[model samples]
Target: MRPFRATVFAAVVLAAVSVSVPVAAAAPGSGSSLPGAGPAVHPDNAALDCPDLLVVAVSGATDSTADRNPIEEETRQLWSNWVGNITVPVGEAKSRYPGSVGWMYVPYPATYGLGLFQDVPTYQDSVAAGVASTNRILDEQKTRCGDRTRFALVGYSVGGEVVERVARELGHRPADAHVGPDDVAGVVLIGDPYRPAGVDSLGAPGPSGGGFMSSEPADYGDLTDRIQHACRPYDIACDAPEEIAVLELALGVLGQMRFTLANPLQTIADAERVVSTMAARAAAHIVSGDDWWQSDESLLDVLRVVADKTRPVPDANLGPDRLREILDWAVGPGLPVVQEKLRAEGAGFVEDNSGVVELVLKPYIFLAFIQHIAYWNNNPHDPWYWESEKIVDWIGALAQEERERDSVGN
Candidate 1:
């Protein structure tokens, strides 16, 4: 395989550093009560308040526990790769406010396993489980703590995506939602794959590009201003360049494949969309007499292989062979015309920055791996600053505000 193709394949497979055991579902708020719990009172009567601020956190892929036992207060304090970042901050904020602040780290699969060679849940399945479990906790807390209690959400890596999804749902305030935008104090995300483009990172300037999975601007409705996203530069999870069509398509294809067994119909639909989009782009390139047809041809080759191997037929009866025949007829004969057009265009679409792409491609992907994992301790640009500290301070300040609010209300 060519260097670019080889690098792309490796990056997609190892994207986000996959490996995790599936976590069992635990009942919401199954953990012990917060410190300085008030006397038991009906939630409908009035605020049965103890903790004025609740910090709900979710850890990243492979950084969470599979055990469903109630997380003891002391165990919750133990340091972890990503969750430790939030816990230390929550602990600090709690110490300052005494019995006025509380926290819970939602437990879920937190896995990104491909499931191709293992029995573990896929990234898609893990994320969905995380979202479900996190929301269950949020719902339970809202009812138990009443409207007076405020919440701050924190998540890192895949956990960040989980939190982002939960926040988006809460922002929309669906009929079944237990928590709304008003109930949230703030949200903090680190190395989130769904981080939108152009949004300002917490402390420093973020990347020019958006997340690999979602490059478009995010909409959080009323919760928009209450959230803070911290993404390191070149972290492919949150800063993939739009110019790299190969990377995007590969991620889409692989990500969809992760959940194929869980939802085959959705997988077929998603695969069809990918192929159709590439087909359209290829046609446009050919019709416009663009020299980029070569690049498109390379991409089509990849899609063809995916279509051939996956045999993603909308109708199972059509059979993989039939689909392969259709794709062959669509692109095989047209290649000659595309090449002729390329020749007519003369020196078509020479990549002015081909060397740059080659030089940075592998390193960029490598850096993304390092940068995504290192947000807990390392900051490449500055050693004096850490993203975790920013989070700690933010959570502390929010907790203080919640404490003060409760004091005023009393």
Candidate 2:
């Protein structure tokens, strides 16, 4: 499979909550996927510049080791990437953040971590913790920066679902939990599993809702469909799996991409090769070791296999030049092609839950590939062409809206 990459925006400040700022919010999945506890947000819109954004990441699928590492790496990468990406040049200011871009996630126990991935219970707990942490971050920001700060949200994959839940909670903040009107600029849900009703500007959601939730990478019957329909202009197979943490993850339990390149394996094929090698080496090491110090023959094989197996398949190019390339792709122009490709690819991608969980075992095998698929098909940062143009437009529009809102109120 090829590596495809895609990657979105926002800004708002505290206003009198007079004019209704229409924006898409995230809604959580119920049943087994639903996390426990409700997030707490207070309606404090007294800040000056703009509202901070709440960025939530999903592990993709499964709750295991393979998914965790990538998530942490992705987060660090994303933060650095976005911090730089969002930093508008004086001339480019009006292009992206017509208003201002400020966002944050509360870092509760597991709410906001360097990288995150987990089971349903762990998810719920994390959500609860995030809500608490989000509140804390906002409160802290408010204390230091003042109240009434505008905000927005970006949820990746299952992380998108978490974002949805938070958005819904934010929208329906109990009388006690209140936030400003444009507190959330928009919920940029990338590869979400489920799309709640009445959302504005919802990104890609698969047959099972909206997200890159694959039972497993090996079970990619739908991938071809997604490529054919979602990425028509370019070759989806040639894009690159490494991009998915920004491409497909942001939803899985481990959110391997979010793991901050914690356990990067470049591509699924590469992952398979690496793990296969690890398994072989581990087996040989155990079998030949005469000393009991390296013993434990009974479980050594299983441990070796599992260890080698739990690695995400992403093509991480953390090199300075590559990172710069990504930034360039994100900021440059000509997005219609990418957007159209995504629409086509995303429209055709299929979803089959048949033993998918068992196959994917957290979907690490193809996390890299899927991430590329999801993003190239939908994200604005796709390098295949000038896809970033659409993002620039969106940012310009949002900034204009905010400026208008502020001007009128003043």
Candidate 3:
């Protein structure tokens, strides 16, 4: 609405906030990274939480249990995989942690697959809501765990975007954060596309790298193609391959910038500063119902905003059956073995301390290596085995780490 606001004083804080902690890019910070990122991350030798606690938040993807039917077994498998499933590849981190850790999956009402992700009036506004929600969750959890518990935030897909928002919001002085380092250890994001709000160019490309199919990988071209074509009326991004001969599209706003809309600062210090400042602003906005620049000026407005963006997905290409198959394959069979492996990672963290975290992602785009394949790739019996499941497993693993961490401490 307002002219993109390059004039905001927030940029002044941006430069000073980007410092690094002793933690490597992959590790927790030794020094504070984001303002509220806690004491440090990648505290290799520090006494880490034996059983780390995790709060796994999923955007409400399904209104009721309807959509979940396909992934019900998988959800159970995921549950077993973390709490106990042996068939999963990643071991259960909770088992190794004892009573010290656990993971609680927050299931919101799903608005189709996009859920509330699409509901944020704008990604920035959604970004604001996510920041508020994270801090609120931390506050509640801190009260629940008292001073003893150390924690982190793990988000998948839209949830990952929430994590990024929290990171950016706390980009100032995390030390002064409402949610102390002792409560929330760090934040972990998975399957995040990090696209900017309302930027049309950011949509996925279609196959043959030309039409609506340019951004999508060629390997699953057929399935995605059907989805694209089916979605033609609803989504601006969804177009048929045949339509490619007519027009060309540009990349989304996020496509121009490599950094996430959630956190723009590259270094740890900057991230902390921005987030802390956001925390301060968010606190004020919460208290006074102000700050419409990014926030919606009121809590109800934010909720309403989140509601507006979500809509139904028309394409059912990889619906219940396919999703179920994916879940079964990833979480079935060696449930005990899988749990064991995840537990092993917890064993790696034998002590307890605190910190922040940030991952400097590679420039690689999602579905980057997809090759041109026939329609058969969509078939469950095909060999490709639907690598999307593997990526999904990665999310499970990331969340599992937090679960295991929480388990060990108690």
Candidate 4:
């Protein structure tokens, strides 16, 4: 029952003052298990019946009290709502193709809070848990399908981080383990934190130059060719720089002064507000057609959380104009410097490449107003959901092709 001390990414400006996040009372059945050695045991391979392709879907962060199962199920449902309509179910996939596509849910500790600070250990635990679940399922699928099953990974936000970790682990997999990139058909990542400047991308480029954890140069092993990253233009979660070192010192000072309150209740309340604002922005940016952000139950829940945690603090009297004035001061002089440095580094000045602009603007625009959450959702002629649907279609195609190959070999 020893606690794992995780250092938050200070550059992200969301690190908790306490620093040491306890892992007690987490989800059941997760501990020191090796990858592919948990929840995927299928001893009777002969009796097992499965689809031709297994789509392992992973979800992003949720509330600390949230269960992984429901999040996994929600991801599966997202696929069903978007992709399942295009093709037949696993039961009917065998007729049109060699076999059908099915979902393999990978459960992980999707602990919530400010990701850079409070959830580092949770992120690590999630990576281990997800990799373990995925590898186990792949092994079982191989055994049951007699080396015929193929894999397609689907991940969103932090879930995408877990997917990348799994892919990296597979690169160094032991010889005894019978799964590798060859068994993996395709990869679809939405707002992945590991997305860098130069990777196989599916849709628009990310805003920040690299992923949240990809400050250093790292590879996704053999899965690079099969992977497709989709990062929205304004989604700072994926596009913001891996390390905003230039801004961290000031941010750290402000975080200590503002976020770290003397009263425990106030601290908790402010943290919840940050998390809520983040969730609202994410939901606002990702939804489509209808103004789901206005009616989103999750957003409503976040509002309730914020309300319940309400308390007075410093800057309580600061109006919007005053807040804007402060922001202008913070980002005004530095914008040119940051932009110039990026240009010198050969970074483009376009919206997608200007991490500094997004880092400053997203909070004011996307995070502040629910009405402003219409970047990807409001447009009809240039629909944003297509970015996600395209990946789903690609996965379906990969599965079909692999199934066809297997059927031909049979």
- Model 4, runs deviating above 4 Å: 1-48, 63-98, 113-121, 174-176, 198-200, 203-208, 246-358, 361-385
lDDT of 1 by residue, 86-151 (tens): 555456546644656666767776665433333455466567767777877777678777766888
Question: Where in model 3 is the C-alpha error above 4 Å?
Answer: 1-51, 60-91, 107-130, 181-183, 195-410
lDDT by residue (335-392, candidate 2, tens digit) is 5533454455333332212223433344435343333233422233455432223333
**Model 2 spans with C-alpha error above 4 angstroms:** 1-92, 95-99, 105-124, 139-148, 174-177, 180-182, 196-368, 372-392
Model 3 quality (TM-score): 0.32
| Clash number for candidate 1 | 0
Model 2's alpha-carbon lDDT is 0.33
Evaluate all candidate structures by whole-model CA lDDT and list the values in order. 0.61, 0.33, 0.31, 0.47
Candidate with the greatest lDDT versus the true structure: 1
Model 3 local distance difference test score: 0.31
Expressed as tens digits, the lDDT of each residue in 242-333 for candidate 4 is 44433322232223222222345655665565566544443333232133223323322223223211111222334577557545744886
Q: Which of the two, 1 or 2, has more lDDT? A: 1
What TM-score quantifies how close candidate 1 is to the native fold? 0.64
